[model samples]
Target: MNTSGGAAAAGRAGNSDALEHLARVGLIALGIVHLLIAWLALQLAWGGGSGSADQSGAMATLAEQPLGKPLLWVLTVGLLALAVWQLAELTRKVPGLRSTGEERKKAVTGTVKTVAKVVVYVFLAITAFRFASGGGQSSSGQEQQTVAGVFAWPGGRFLVGIAALVLIGVGVYHVHKGVTKRFMKEIDAAQTSAGERRTIERLGQVGYPAKGVALAVVGGLLGWAAVTFDAAKASGLDGALRTLLEAPFGKALLTLVALGIAAFGVFAFFRARYPERT
Candidate 1:
């Protein structure tokens, strides 16, 4: 009749090979989204047409495909599964993590990232569901509207500033992960052949920084909006990329970023194939 023991048993029961497989499918869905985003970014670089280059944009692109609705359903299922897997990790213990100083710090950091992953997967999954159910719409400039909504709340400016800092911090961590090759730990290095490992490493080195830099820019804009009391300035990912396109030498830079995003998408496929870290 021990409630805690029963809860622990239930948590363990949620861990299964089927769940892991579904999680891998989520990674695949993630890769597809990123690849589509990359393609959208490239279009922005070359044509500068008015289109969203964020997750919503990616989902929109999927909706236009021949089997788009079905694909969206698949993507939704995969992302939801991945989110569940990551959420379950919140209550589970790391295999080798101990209660020591460095180990403890690593544990905390890993938990934070896992939580971020869960949020990301759930968001993407919900977006997919919306599109699948014919409720999706173009998300351009919604970030500004969302921020404006927050501005109506009491002390909302402070919350926006804090959110900006979190985005920047996560962005920096991604850059650090890429530059230090720490992203390798996110996968099973032992499972791949030498060539495959090298390919993944190369992809991570480029991809993580590209993603990190983009997130940092988004955060920087949010921070600016908080300071100016102008929600229009905080346009989120779509705006950040568009801002780059408006800058001097921006086309070249955006193209590089787009390529890097594509690299990340490819790396995600390999991650799906391995998924040991998941």
Candidate 2:
């Protein structure tokens, strides 16, 4: 009986570890998908037309494209999945309140992060659906209509700008908590070696800057568009790139920015593959 019990316990332990590993992999995959979407959004925001010969304006150009609709749906589902995975990880890591006050504080932080993640995912889904449904006015017919008629309502740009700000704030708070609270220590404890610690730290560092830059660029563009009531002028990614290119030093700067964003995606890919040994 004792021997049988030990074997069962070991099996359960192995299964639990595998589940955690799978959850981590899922989270990483979701992150990569998001980064890819960001890159595509950036490419479109730049001077690259949707590769279509249509007379459609910029919005229509993006909407009518084959990749646009699929990308939108992919992002929507991926973000929701990410949110769920994050919450699950938090629950697994902190199944209950610890006796120590510090542990309790960490639990609170995790809860806040989970909530923030849910909000971001919800808004992202809405944005994706709006884009996919042709409600965003990116089609040729919508483009031919008055720009005022489409952009005047302050729907797309305004909501996205607000969501970006919230995401940035949440990301910053999480990073701060991670560093100050030494949350990575928990991860390190689960890891086997010092090298794993270094790897996880590097991933965290890269993630921080990427999230910050994305938030700032998207948020700033939306805010500017909302105030100026210029939907065409306020579009994300492309508009920002266009503004940069129009400046005397804009082209060079835009190139560097694009490369930096792409590099982030590359970094994400690496992190996802190797991940932290935890």
Candidate 3:
């Protein structure tokens, strides 16, 4: 054992309880955002004047409400705190991966996941800031522009192809994770009642696959972009959601997925309630 590393980990552990609660609040905020998205999706399903039904759209809708700026500011702070919490987690040692190879592999994978989470939270924080400041832009438009710009570069097609493949893989992983109930491993058994665990599991069974389907749709769009060399085809979440609108029985499908996403939001609440701080 490295003494310095051990000491650092111990110091982090001492503060984990407090930070964990803060992270829980952040998770709640995340759930709220997803719930809003689900509502927008429902409206779209009913041919109502729903906005984009993605994260930016969600942010835009929030900005239109009373005291929206203050709410966004609060969300930003919570998200930042969550990012910091993940940072602390990235530094701490894994408890159960005792074998050298297992530990190394687990550490690397964990770090990557934590880092990805940090990026996501930070991006959301920035998005909130943008919306609060009245400078929000269309996420799909930006995504298309970004993809177009990427295609301008040498080997950009290859890069875009790689990204598409990665997203596809991630989508598959999420579906598999949901099917296998692997996410339950993150729950603190001591903190969760049997009923609560069952509820969380059931919600996750629907939620994860719904999210996976959305991701897979987005990946297919990106793949289409690569194949046709048309960056406009590589629209983000908004495009994927809208694409569902064009399909046969689209409204019903969209509504079902929206509810699944809402279930995910509720699942996040349970996760916040019974987090296993590793």
Candidate 4:
């Protein structure tokens, strides 16, 4: 047994752990914020209307708030950082060609993920900048501004929605690959105990579905909104949740969706702690 190889593997694992931890924490925080925003959107949508007020509107209330811009900027920066970290990890792994065919497969998967992250980060950065700047002409012939930027722009919204859908699709693929391909082999290769393998598999099974669903729902809603020129309808978590809530049986559905998202966050945290198993 080459102790040097084991030590190097351990070091790589540690670095992977740290990066995964950061990603998980960021995602969980984002989810909580999203839920809070959803609640706010709900209030604005259902609360009694003022004179000619469109209570079911997404931007109507958020546009008046001061914290919106700051929040958007924070999210934009955080997502970009995550993208960079993912890309760096992929690059580091790429140069080390493996003799094992499975190891090579994992590297390829990781590379694909890195490329996707880069694209996502670019889209998010552009959208965030557009939101920070005034987006379009207002009734007063001044640029209209919102914290999250052009909740109203069909083009931008559609692009973002497409990006989100791609992300969801990739996440689903990862779930499949992680479960059926990567982690199972790890368990076998380690000669791990059955109980440990089961635990690891369970985590993968649960976490992936939650992630897939959240991404899918978010993407679908955004895309639909874009097509209808109802970009304002899904501007934020609050707006998206409000759209669900306003549906028939929306209140109940919203509760389920919120719980699902929160569960996904928790699962993501667990996955980060045991990335090797996942």
Candidate 5:
């Protein structure tokens, strides 16, 4: 028996536990970010101050508060932990992956979801770090620049179109999850009260579709960018919300969506409180 192997296993277990703890805290940080974004979006909806309503903008707002820098550091660490946790989940084998066809399909879908989360969390972690270090930029500007760079490449339009389609699919999935109360699968129902379940369900019903609408608009903008060969049309979340203002009864729509987003942020707090261990 190699004592060294046992020591390494113990070390790995300790690290995993630390990462799990961080991931739990990260969920709370994520909720705070969403709540900030919701506030900015509401300001726009109600004809108030001018501020970008996106993740980067949220980070910037956080930076303006007391102890903001230290908070950024904590957010950065938490997000990084979340990214690592998702990556680990993505790579881990699914239970009964080889047992049945339905199980195999579920495993594949779960893997894809985990992979997407890993990408999102990593991007968010980078954004958090940038704000923490006082080196943040407008998310809208960054999106346009990235789209422009993509267009400069050969066959870029088609690639952008494909990306738009992917976004739409993701949006639809969120809507479906919300409408179907599928998100409850991630909650430890056995540990929750009936009232809590009802509250979560109600929140999911409103919040998920709101997120879906936002993503759908973002995808549409990307599609416009692809079709017109104009990278400027491909804006981020802030751009999407502004575009909403250009339509009929836009303010009302934006306000509704903003409320839904705020609800999602509140739901995220519930998630932090009642996470389902894998």
Candidate 6:
């Protein structure tokens, strides 16, 4: 009767299951949002669209549809579940991995990344909740207001510059992850069929770089804003997409990007089916 091994086994088997299920549902919600964003981008690419080209626009679109509010509520729950999953991962361990020096370094890195994700997921959840509860406000306006506030703070420009660099770094990481197929680490390949793995791989390879490109442009906008002290330059994802649309060959470029984002959305479905195990 070895209690220690039994406890570890049970811990591995039981506690995270509900979290994992909720996280998968959250993945679906994420997929839907990205897909909606892509659709809006496409609309903007051609001629006209109703919503802005970002998450808020996506949520607003969702809110306008049949049973939209209920769906928003579901998404809110899902996103919060994802945030909780990230929080749990802050202390969760792979059952067999030892705490070696290298592993410890990896753990530290994972913790930092997890913390970032938790913030994102929580923010997204709040946004979804607002939309569901009819308290929704303008995401772009909120960003602008926040930027304006930061400008008033002492050494605010410096802080803004630092933020710009962080966004750029994250953008680069997303690109690297996609190009290198490093995202495979997050999926349990054993659970997927061979064709599914290939399909997922292709989707990620396209999706990540597209998403990365958008984020990098966003960071550049922030950097520009910081240097010129123009809060308007710091407009987020919606602004980023619109900026691309204005570039030469912009229509074609934006179309491709929209498709790439759609790829990411599709990839999320696969991810929901086969989640991260380690």
Q: Candidate 4 or 6, higher lDDT?
A: 6
lDDT of 6 by residue, 24-140 (tens): 889999999999999999999998885688988889899989999999999999888888777666545443235778787777778779899889888888889999999886676
Candidate 5 displacement at residue 243 in angstroms: 1.2
Pairs with steric clashes in candidate 1: none
In terms of TM-score, how similar is model 5 to the real structure? 0.91
- Per-residue lDDT tens digits of candidate 5, residues 212-240? 99999999999999999999889899999
Worst 10 residues of 2 by lDDT: 51-60
Model 2, stretches more than 4 Å misplaced? 1-81, 90-109, 118-211, 225-234, 237-248, 274-278
Candidate 3: the clashing residue pairs are none
Best candidate (score: TM-score): 1
Q: Which residue runs does candidate 3 get wrong by more than 4 Å? A: 1-14, 93-100
Q: Which parts of model 5 are misplaced by more than 4 Å?
A: 1-16, 94-100
Sequence-dependent TM-score of model 4: 0.47
lDDT for 118 in candidate 1 is 87
lDDT of 2 by residue, 82-115 (tens): 4554555554445445545777777776677667
With a 3 Å backbone cut-off (N, CA, C), the pairs that clash in candidate 4 are: 37-238, 38-238, 131-149
Q: Candidate 2: lDDT over CA atoms?
A: 0.50
- Scored by Cα lDDT, where does model 5 land? 0.85
- How do all models score by TM-score? 0.93, 0.49, 0.90, 0.47, 0.91, 0.91
76: Cα error in model 2, Å: 8.6
Candidate 3 lDDT tens digits, 107-207: 77887777878998989889988988889875858888899999999999989998898788778877887899987876786787888888989988888
